[model samples]
Target: MGSSVAGLIGWRRATRICKTFLFSLILTTASGAVAQADCRADQVELRWPGGQARFSVELADDEAERARGLMHRETMPRSAGMLFAYETPRRAQFWMKNTLIPLDMIFADQQGVVTRVHSNAIPQDTTVIDGGDGVQFVLEINGGLAKRLGITAGAELRHPKIASSLWACDVE
Candidate 1:
């Protein structure tokens, strides 16, 4: 009788542990979803041949942001992108991992002129996509949008931050 009672207690404890673990898994997933939503909330504006558009730019001014650029996103808005800004133009490369949607990468020189374009980057691809000749800015947009909108090399960006003679704090 005592052995049977101990077995029941052990089973109850095991069930409780399982429930706890499941709950933790759910919470972790929810937290991750919330974080992703928050990270892409802020919007950045840009001009394309179609018209002006806004994007949730994942600005990469440092190593950490650059490393984590747009990974694991299930969807990207048609007008949205991650903009990698550097102090000066340099040779930069990109890859897609856990990025559900394909993209068109637009590389811009320090003067904000489009320098290169990589269209239709396959999702989850680890291929080292090159942006040759260096650039000060890199914009990642929905795949094929660059071609569709006629946003090609030499297209200029109108962001005030890239414009010269703008007040430092007032520039956007």
Candidate 2:
């Protein structure tokens, strides 16, 4: 009777260990999936020439997002624009290689005024579209809309995060 009782206790201990191990594995996997889902920005509202236009923008602040800029997407919403925030204002250039949809690149200064506009960027083209000197931010929108709306150099942008980050309000 004593030996049988010991065996039963050992079996129960093993079962408890197995259950704990499986629960840990499930919890780890769930947390990882949640982290991946939260990595991309869902929507962003930006100020444009027309007014405050809300966009489902993908923020390209790092090398990963920069490399994946608008590629493979079948369509982009009209009110949406990708906002690429850089460390400093410089001459930025972009090309439409592997990009599925046409886009209008609106380049702006640190203060958000449009400094240059590259409209109708041809997909699969390696030709460099220059966003001339002192360009801090680049907003990608639908093709030809920049020209139609007169969203050229000197167009101001108004994103709360962008404006606050790059403006005097952020100064120490």
Candidate 3:
């Protein structure tokens, strides 16, 4: 029948070009995993020792968003914060049970410096709050705004998950 209708129209045009290249490789791998999970909102900068502050963070790096920190937020916006990222410098601990507000944890190092702050905390207060050793980023903010923006203990955060950060992030 005319070479079986030209081999059934070349097998329906090779199955429509293999379903349009598998739908454009699944939409470019789901938009690169939604741009790496929305690159966590960033922007940190602390400085201190005379003063300098600016927050707007929110990164929680993983392990289920740092075990769901800032639990049931009732309100947290005095410039806003919540960092947590840890991949090495250990000895960081925190608690505030179900969280509900009051914070100020800080603690850095891994090059982000700061080392420890702790402050306010009490709000559901489960107590723990250590952050000693070499730490590795923690920031929480709001409670007393890290001693009303002095952010002590050698301060100097400037984020982007401190890859030796002394204030790195220009686009990494």
Winner by lDDT: 3
Off by over 4 Å in 1: 1-56, 163-172
What does candidate 1's lDDT look like per residue over 11-52, in tens digits? 999998787556334323323332233212244444444344
Angstrom error at residue 131, model 3: 8.5
List per-prediction Cα lDDT, in the order shown: 0.68, 0.68, 0.73
Steric clash pairs (candidate 2)? none
Error of 1 at 10 (Å): 63
Query: Against the hidden reference, what TM-scores do the models get?
Result: 0.64, 0.64, 0.27
**Model 3's lDDT to the true fold?**
0.73
Indicate the worst ten consecutive residues by lDDT in candidate 2.
30-39
What's model 1's lDDT at 150? Answer: 65
Assess the local accuracy of residue 93 in candidate 3 as a C-alpha lDDT between 0 and 100: 83
Considering lDDT, where higher is better, how would the candidates rank from best to worst? 3, 2, 1
6-31, model 2: which lDDT tens digit per residue?
Answer: 99999999998787556334323323
